[model samples]
Target chain A: MVLLFTAGCRAKVSESPIGPSVQLHAPLGLPPVPIPPDNPPTEATIALGKRLFYDIRLSKDNTLACATCHDPEHDFSDPHPISLGVGGAKGIRNAPTLINVAYQSSQFWDGRATSLEIQAASPIADPLEMNQTHKVSVSKLAKDPVYRKMFTDAFGSKDVTLGRVERSLASFERTILSGDSAFDRFQYGGQPTALTPAQARGLALFINPIKGNCAACHTITPQYALFTDGKFHNIGIGVNDDGTLKDAGRYHETTVKSDTGAFKTPTLRNIANTAPYMHDGSLQTLEQVVSFYAGQGNSNPYIDREIKTIHLDGQERSDLVEFLKSLTGKLPPNLEEEKSHP
Target chain B: MTRFYSRLWLCLPFALVITGCKSSPPPPTAAPAKPAVSYFKVDPATAGSVSGKITFSGRPPARKVIDMSEDPACVAAHKGKAMEESIIVGNKSGLENVFVYIKSGLEGKNFETPTATVVINQGGCQFHPHIIGVQVDQPVEITNSDPVTHNIHPMAEINREWNHSQGPGDPPMHRKFVKQEIMIPVKCNIHSWMHAYIGVLNHPYFTVSKEDGSFTIANLPPGTYTLATWQEKLGTQEQQVTVAPGGQAVINFTYKGRS
Candidate 1:
């Protein structure tokens, strides 16, 4: 929860702590993150949001907050495949990385949520997660004049509605775009020194529709680096641990049969940084992920018919993993260690 | 073939029992060869679109920390963003998305296809006209833009079950409801946020609110009928509206807080 501004922050960022910070340009290959015109990213908002991100005080028992499950050191992902809620309650789905989420169209694997403004408030009251109610959280924040002042400044007026929280959180999150990486340099920058031969081969197979068809959802564009199409697909990973036939995928939301076992195709931009891929977080390692794809997904009734086991060996898996590794980007510069919490 | 005839014969009695209004879009499914119904002549007149907005009555709920249910993929990815909070626009509308439409009585209106077809396009990765009301048994085209496949799944009790995928640049999906239904939940089998409401009324006397909270149902027959507004969390309310022949009737529905 450290919000320390390292020495590099003042030197690199164009705006120190003013209206909206335009220090880090949106990576070449993506649309400029569309911040809501009403609530632009103010330094105070970012600082407050960051504090909230790391503040365990938001929970009922003061055990967890957003950061307890999502760690910046681990590419903003909880190292555990699935996250544990308050009182060590085990959740059904694995924790997803918050990296490059500003580009996403909808929230959640099933696409049940349409906006970050809507998705942000789901966890606090989820019995299995924070196990806290919004009334209590707001009551606690009401006690803190600093938080109240920040909320009013960030969102005008002092009601401190949940919508503002979602928007502010979304605004802070909008800054977490992932683009600058070796793969980016090699592909967009045309720097031959960036990508290794094995990585280049892996990239080719990824985009080559006949080979990897990775472009089917994990799209790479000249405007944006290789992330994803922000669409859901059935990659054939099942979470039987939850006693689900195929996790119901997007079908659970829409009640459509074709969506029976589909899930959102997550961005592969931070693939190197985000371990344990897939909606269920079943796959542990990148090697295992590529191998799963090579093997055409886990066998299940609702398995996507497109899940065809193809030919891939250990070496190819390693090569693909190497290419994915090339996508690691420089961390958000000048991260201050969160003020040591009591 | 004999079995199909028997089923068709069984359906005939039902149609006769409740013969549709004079201008039914498609014939009653009494018999495929000689349906016991009338097809509404396609009208060349322009139809007005109705839209409005919904606001809350009290302080909306704060962001709830959502848990990643059984799916680890969702858990790992949404550790921070999940169940954060829902957007509460305007004052205090508890729930945002509300499916509002003429519940009944419109099922027998004379419905004729119009030259100007409403698209209800899927643009910017969201379903346009989040709440859509169309004449029952009319082809509502679902189109896609992003270079990926998206499946359209409509959960309705009255409509024939249909689920299909439209690829990028694929042909528009022409789906029709054979019967009248209301507040039919429409969602993309692909994305959860891609939600929509299809008001499948047999008549054209229905409309939805825009983001600013205003709506108008055009060409409504000059008559006093019950007008209703319903939000998801805030329940429903009804008001009587009267219109003269070829004259417009102005009606305003204000939710007394969450109605």
Candidate 2:
């Protein structure tokens, strides 16, 4: 039997000598999780990434880590509408939940980064994020013996590079999946008694194309329910009060005429857990979000055709909100605090 | 004469022999023989192959980074972001995914259609084979491997246009193009970055360039044929060439690169 030490705790690795590959417990019917060829998860890489995830040294001031904004207690999201960065600088969009982020096609509200590796580097350099350049961070980490050993163990070299940092962070983020919700139990887990009658009714309304029509974009197949199509849409949220588009969402990247106000559609997986919703965090509660959709969103030229008029009564509105609430899945085990070094 | 008559009487059907007295048969002549029809066959002695490498002359265009933010599932399917395959220039500056085929040769000749189906997989919110070719009336099976739903809409000019959605667990969608549409562009409206082109021809002489920019169209009958190369970014180029029976012809297409 091989003894493995992780997060200052000793564990037994009875299965294999090469260390066990973290088998992600994906929700029933979810497609196999995609792992990048260059960054296939190993115990060493995951352990290194987990340490870096919670390491304050990643930031310039050492006061904030990734967990500062993406607090696991808050479902890997912040309660604030816009998250604060290194110097308490306000961000443009809400700190979206990292839960089940492995399933997203792109990163950020704008969908700028193609991979998690690309996305990982942006926040480290963003003035409003970790506020540390890759060069500075790499240099700072080179002096630490623990990080050097971890890097060498994770990668083949002791040298800390930006690419390695991105890969490790992405590896850690990939493991943060959320599933096994009450909805998952009822829908895919062979547990018919998991969801309440109200949730069952809500599920029906959410999928009915003529009524709720929510599933048109928030797709729900028989086996999996990601509750998001993973495409960007202009839902009239960022349109200014004077009828002009404000944020320009995906248009900033693609410059397409239709994408002028389009922003990526956020997943409704843990909608209840991550509050102050929408890209701009304009809506305060689930009721407001449902009401915004029911009212066919703020009337704008570029609004997605899927967002149409849906007149729901008070009870139906409550039922829909309850269904959204049912999307909260069990978060994975949290990483323990790293012990201080002498 | 006695032996022949006895054998005929014994070999003839009993009912026919009894009814033979009621009807007089016509004078015997050579049995009418069915004329044999000649099917089209490629004479190996007169067959040749066309091989070439697609190279870029100037700087290649930068691939567009596909924004999959619209669907998190798409982003999640890929490790990082996926890029557009429109102008894939390798280290050798060889362009990829160019559809090369015999454009004019064997126009009036009919060829047998392949019974096996061609597959186009939609994985990681992008088309697996960016460029493909199929004989007319041959089925192209499109499968969705990603966890998310993808709506495949092929906008064809000569053939009927089709738009269909396939989920992960659902069976693959099979489609056939009847007419000879040179290149039909397919786009997944659900995932804009997911696009592919299918080249349809009536004959079997067509090939798409691989990552290394090499392509081969084999088993061509000896003829002076107009071969056309079509790339998504760089427009079509046509060349006229003659091949000796059982000979090989080499042809190369160079596209001016765009920065």
Candidate 3:
């Protein structure tokens, strides 16, 4: 029996030794989640990642967790315009929704990180955020017997490293996808009554290049709608009173003058849930965002030329907001937080 | 019999290592390696030429004035004369920036991927030549001459899509498309007004119409070919033309403006 077991273990060493792999449950209307080649998800990895994501031990003071800012009830985003970090330190930008983020070409408003794995490590080390080094964070996890077992089950070893932690966290995030909204059903699922008359009218105006032209950047394709072109643009946002950009945005990453005020076009999948619009999170509501665009986006020298002033009457404005609300979709199941170790 | 059974149990681990641990056959070796093809050379003695003019009929769309007020550098570069290049009509209704190429006829033939790189310069916050063509695997170099930064993004449908930021004084980016994709739309996310198109073909017989709406595809083996002209807004038109040995074929395409 020992020989048989040893033979089995040795035989599967080259294959998936971490048990069976699992597919992400992506709702309809969204494309398949683009998983990294090296970090294929398993049940063990996802469970470990979820525990790590919600654990306050990852922070310096053991007070802040990923879920503290990215609250699950609020569509995996922070309600505050700027997220409060460990020891009450405030972050520079709004906490973007984790829903459908796996589809994004790059991470963050500035797109400084190319992948979720790379983005996962930034907040843990940032002074204003978690304020914890990878070494300390790994040590915290390694000391816990439960975490040691979980890490062993997930990654085939009791030794915990930052790379495995990042891979696991990214794997869990890849599953927090949302899609199959009312707008998606109406547009792709051929459900005529999925949208109200006002929303239908708004959809028409949204696509009309001369009218709303909202789809110019918040794109919708014939097949599926990711609602983002995955490109940065300065739409007159964050312009100060002195006619200069308050936030350099993409410019800081690329050191390009034209990208001075530009920021990534965030996905609009669950736009209603993740409020306080734009990269700065200044706009309080969808109406203000729409109105800002209607006024041709705060006219700075670096503003996108696509932002032409448009006339949206009272009725049109309300309908456009209604259409945006229809974008709120169903969240993935099994997001309930597990009790943390005392 | 007991000795034989003990020996069989010991050999089971090696059998599992041989069969169970083996990888899945390497994906059929990617369509059998493709037969080695020789480079096609144009026989100058029997080579033909296809010269054509792309003309616009009716009223052309008025070029919208580009507002570069936001970027002081772009405004200074164009001297406030920057306009949309979607529709550039020359004298006598000659339509510029139309891509003309042989759509069909030279098949199963391989052409040398041009060693000379096709340059697309970003000057004054706009793509210098709005429309371009290149053979498959031909190098397409993008250079930024503007004082500002420009992110070049190619939204290719059939080919791989890529987006990169290129700042002034940065080295030119070299890229090539392995697949034949027609009219890949390129955009600058930084400057939303900046747009360009690239057409990739397997053969070397392709050219963009000049400012006077003239295009000439020289060095073509004499044969009947289905020629096509593509205008960004006006759509595409196709025509069949037969070229006599060493003869010049004249073909003109007319695109009507939207009524």
Candidate 4:
């Protein structure tokens, strides 16, 4: 895993004579972009990655792409409760938003993958997902002249290796950052009038230890806020009627008993745009999600200690939801504009 | 003694080279140069020990029952009787798992980092010996002996934090903390309830209290030291203790329970 302290360092694309090195500037309230030392974001590589992200050839039967589930228009998250892959294969968990994912310590709800490069390779081979072998995916990309040239431009060689593919995809995903929202203006921008009365009250409860206590896990430092602790917690979601976990979320990967209903904490940035929250996408709206927390989560043995019973009247609940909405921020420029080719 | 003297001779050239590189005098506030010896050696005749009992005065908190039903292997391993180890109180209210160490007074002392590795095993879905101490730069070997995968995550503040997944039959992971951190909390994100604490010190004068609540730091050079004991839930307590040459210093600490 990438060290947490290095995640905030402004990483520049390595000097390359092939293309202009893109200097990724973090927007307000977000920390500097952490570019992998080996996979720096040259314009050629980002362009190649963007083209690969939108290419259906990466999937079997030429139907699915990374963008199919992580839709740029929907805060880079799927609208469905759980994502549907090629051949309508149903996924077990919700497709989490990729916004600000460059800051995450681990990937996937289970956090099985340590790096984004590792994460980008899993779905293409998973039977329920893209259902394509890495070898075949590389072969398909290699078959195209346009892809061959792009690969050469990105990696200084025409060889389309799986490692290069993973790196390029990760480099592109790192640029999908979002920050500088109304909440940022009010909290960090020194503008007290940025938020309405309800949003201001909601922010109060969000940070109040005894009230919302959301800040305990959705951390907000004095300088910036990622809205996530990057730790796993069993918030009592997906519990069966018999008190057994419907899905042994994180435990499937770790085999640790307490991890039985746990999942990685999703960032609350642009949460207003990503509907159907939680790992399972059980609650449809922010109100239901807040109510679930207020109800102290479904009682289970491994539930997080931070999940405490709290009182939030209708007004307070609405204010909290409004405060969450204020978190929706500006996306990176040209993110929504689809590039047809590299 | 001969080997120690030979190692000091081997380090003299490198020490001189380091000093020769400096063009200006060090600031007055700079620390004194470390001794050229490879390691500090305590005189066997003058060496003393600090031993103590960590006791709890009030009623101990009830241990919470752990539900391991999700993993049948874990359930079978514990036979449905696994309990939380947050506050393990034994006979005479002796607190188990309290980390006792020489928190200060060992400054400027360079003890040789032990080559022997500290082993922590994952079995029965829990970390065995939930609290432990290791010298800085000493290797900590973590092994998974269960029929499942285990992820070891050390949330160290001073040391670099890392997490790795270890599956059944996988080779043990050897890691070391480069800096001194009083206590680093470790957790398995996969197993949210599994918790452990690691106390990393530069010196070798640290140990965890056993189930009987007794701890000992042996082979210490006689001196006054700031001794500290840390409990996971009860927090930390410090005291001043002076050990006479060749004498054992006995101390005791008490923690009150919540009313």
Candidate 5:
């Protein structure tokens, strides 16, 4: 009910009570979409951002676009947890799906960076990723008069800055939100036949604080349960390549001793699409992730203090994993728009 | 005689049981206890503040162009808005975002916190105001006003630190200074060059500069204080000044150039 900094468009922000409620296309069960005061989601910004997102020419080699890794068809992920970037270099972490990313707190597995605009730019420069510098990208886009016009219209001035690029990409990303999964009907709406008794029981065990402990991190809010706490935790990830703990995750950046082994808690919605879980993409299946937590985290020194040894029987563990599998939602809206890869 | 003898035996047995119970008591009650309180206070201390402004002295500093990275999907850390420092229009002032704070002293000061923590937004991919002067023990809300995501990474040594990425549409990032330090360096890792400075003081005697490079700290409680200034490119300079109650005392320091 809290409309924070929005102009009512009869969509929630703009429409005054006097105006007819613009046939609200907002998916059932979601907090009002938060839009910044300066850059409210316009038909204009979204169009510009979408154009840039699909444009392969945005890359240094003109071989890939944002959809190259986040193919909308395969549940917004490429199915390969760790993806190949420009020059066919493998990435360090899995290609996380864009479903419900609007609800996330931090972006990367290590959480080294924050904000989508900032997060969008890292890959373009990382040698192992897009491998394109800002200058190279702007110059490449500048070659096309159409893009130049689009950039000018979306950002007022035609002076292409990194800020404009990041803002555009981030705007496109916000449109890729996820909801309306089958499981939601089975739970929230009284569609009793939606889920079998077994899945229902599975949901019960999944929510149990003592046995599952999944809700602590993978939250299950009553409405629009994005299934994430949007916080960071160590979760006892494996040691680093140097035989020392891996990039101290958040610790490497902040040097606050407590963050020594922690990584951002990933969203569980459509987590099944993004395989090879964790920061390093080590775990292969939902079963593996479930079993890892069942073992109360790898019993490592840097493991989070909250990760305690759990005692889930075989049936309970199987049901909990099933509950997670049910979270696989529908493919993103723009999947068809995303060009198919071979 | 029989009744008396029976009562005497029962009394002896009960006395023996009582004696045993008194000799071996529960160990759980052995330790001394303290009252429960939310936070531990260091000492009886009054609230304080720090204020100062940035100075180019003669001319404004030059501005640097911002760059974006080219990493792939999930290649970047966070995808959100830019801070206030990242996208401000012009800064002839060469080096902006000079943070100043007291490095030591002023841990656990007793001060009334404001109803709502103040928000230092990162709009237009830059830090709003470029520089902030805050009293120690005050809370700061680092907000991302831009459509893109931003991470508020504060490099603090004397107090509890934070490094959080603020995504679009997400709640604001709230933080408090439990300890007092002269200055803290705040940065956005996404924008390698995007930086801002915050000056934290134990007393209300700090000010950051407007575009004109004018800083001020008002409402002093009649005391001698060490006032300081910091520049992102230039080092720190401090001077001593005395202010009468309810009166303003102006303090200034000059630096030759970036050290």
Candidate 6:
């Protein structure tokens, strides 16, 4: 992806791109991103990971790829309620947006995997997903002379292992982080005119504890504007009619009774473009999601304590959703146009 | 003439109440008693038991090594090598992880739900105990010790089927199986190789075979009962036996391997 630097925000960013260890430019007010010591981000590894991310051969039936579900045109998220996998098989949860995913502490809707590298292998072998075994995928890549050279360029040797595959994919995903937007310009860039009067008012209500209270989970600090706490909570989606959990959310992972129906809190960055919100994609529009919060979410026993009644009238609700729309920013450059595919 | 005067005196009180004078109502009568229900109680002194051993006649297959290259946390935990436990055979060709329980008899009995927690630990991307038995309504605590995330999904036939993802340091999950379904398969959706079986029963007379393939069910009242054994790969076996007061009934099962 192309990293464009504008004249207005150069003071807020510190970017340094080296050979095998590229230090990504942190947007204004954000902390330095953590990188694993062993799998340092080299330009070659990032390039290789980009190819694997978009290649359809990663799946058993070469019909689907990571890009098939996380389309760049849709802000790296599936527009459908659930992602469609091999043989038209459907996933159980909605595809989360990859924007600002580098800042996330955990991965997946339930936060089952801890890192992007680890999460890369799950969909490939999942029977209802890519259905391609890691062993077989590595052997397929080994036969190709181009992939073999690329592997040697990224790692010290050309020997292909499943670990290398995950590392490369993670490196590519780390480059997909988002930051710059109207909200960032207004808050961090010291641009007074970036947001409208309605948006400014909406931002106020969003942080007000008794008002929108959205900042409780989707934090909006002046230092960085990620608009997410990166924690999990159950906002009462996918709950059974009798108050029992239908999906069981984080509870399925932790076995904690209180975590029932809890899912990772996704970033509000570029949320307007990524419609069909929530873990289940049950809410079609941002306005609907705002309304759901206004009504204090669905009545479930395990609903997050922060999801209390927000007494917002119709006009206030619309203003809050408008503020969420201002989170849209420039997306990563399209990888399909790159001429590096093998 | 005297009896006629007495009857006239009794009618005079009612006649007076109709003339604007208030009178009190009659008192209520006692309700009829309900029939008592007979509940089955163990006579401890006369309780019997059924003990058995599960044996395999054929050669055990070589265990498969798990490939955890995708997640380094799991690989590091296992020190780069981990084996599958689909069919664990101990000494003397005894098979482990078999669910043994009393299938029939002891009707009209009410067994108290066990309050003790049954723990199933997930470490190195595999269940610590591949097989577990819990009485209906008994708490089962599922825990994860690895630094990575693991999702636990129980595919129960006669009970609620549910799935959840658990990350490292998260609190242990507590659940109860409310049905008497045996061999409810449990799997980790994240790691395909991670699997376990849970046996839920109405009575507490059930035990999973240890590493030696031996199991004993005590506190069985003196009666005729059908003992059942279940294995994931091998189907199941049932045997009828009668136990005398404080006597032990020996029932052994043998499974022949595929030739």
TM-score of 2: 0.53
Please write out the lDDT profile of model 5 over residues A177-233, one tens digit for every residue.
655555677766667666666667677877777767777877777776777777778
- On a 0 to 1 TM-score scale, where does candidate 5 land against the true structure? 0.50
User: Worst 10-residue stretch by lDDT in candidate 1 chain A?
Assistant: A1-10
Tens digit of per-residue lDDT, candidate 1, span B70-131: 22333443334544322434433423444445554344455543222345566544566566
Tens digits of lDDT, candidate 4, B1-259: 1232233334534544554566465465634585343345566688898998999888888999987655555666655578899999999889998999898888887776666667888888898768878778877788988765555668888977655555556577677888999899988645566789998888878777877788888777899999999999999999999999998999999888875
Task: Give fnat (model 2).
Answer: 0.00
Worst lDDT run of 10 residues, candidate 6 chain B, spans: B1-10
lDDT of 5 by residue, B49-97 (tens): 3344444544433344343432221123235533334222224432334
Q: What does each candidate score in C-alpha RMSD? A: 24.9, 26.7, 21.7, 19.0, 30.1, 28.5
Which pairs clash inside model 3?
Answer: A301-B70
Residue-by-residue lDDT tens digits, candidate 6, A262-329: 99889998899888788887777776677567655555678899987556654676789889988888
Residue B149 of model 3, lDDT score: 56
When 2 and 6 are scored with TM-score, the better candidate is 6
Error of 2 at A5 (Å): 35
Superposed model 5: Cα runs more than 4 Å off: A1-26, A157-159, A240-244, A338-342, B1-259
Q: Evaluate residue A7 in candidate 1 and report its C-alpha lDDT on the 0 to 100 scale.
A: 27
Best by lDDT: 4
C-alpha lDDT score of every prediction, in listed order: 0.61, 0.75, 0.80, 0.80, 0.58, 0.76
Q: In every candidate, what fraction of the native interface contacts is reproduced? A: 0.00, 0.00, 0.00, 0.00, 0.00, 0.00
Span of 10 residues, lowest total lDDT, candidate 5 chain A: A15-24
Model 3 agreement with the true structure over A1-342: per-residue lDDT tens digits:
743454445433432228777988667688777887778889998898888889899999999889888889788888898888888998788888888878888998999999998887679889999999887887788789999899889878776777778878888888888779999899989998999999999899899888789999898998878889999999877665335788999999999999989999988888888887788777777866665665465556788878874656546766888999989888877775886667
DockQ of each: 0.01, 0.01, 0.01, 0.01, 0.01, 0.01
> For every candidate, what is the interface RMSD in angstroms?
14.0, 15.3, 14.6, 17.0, 15.9, 14.7
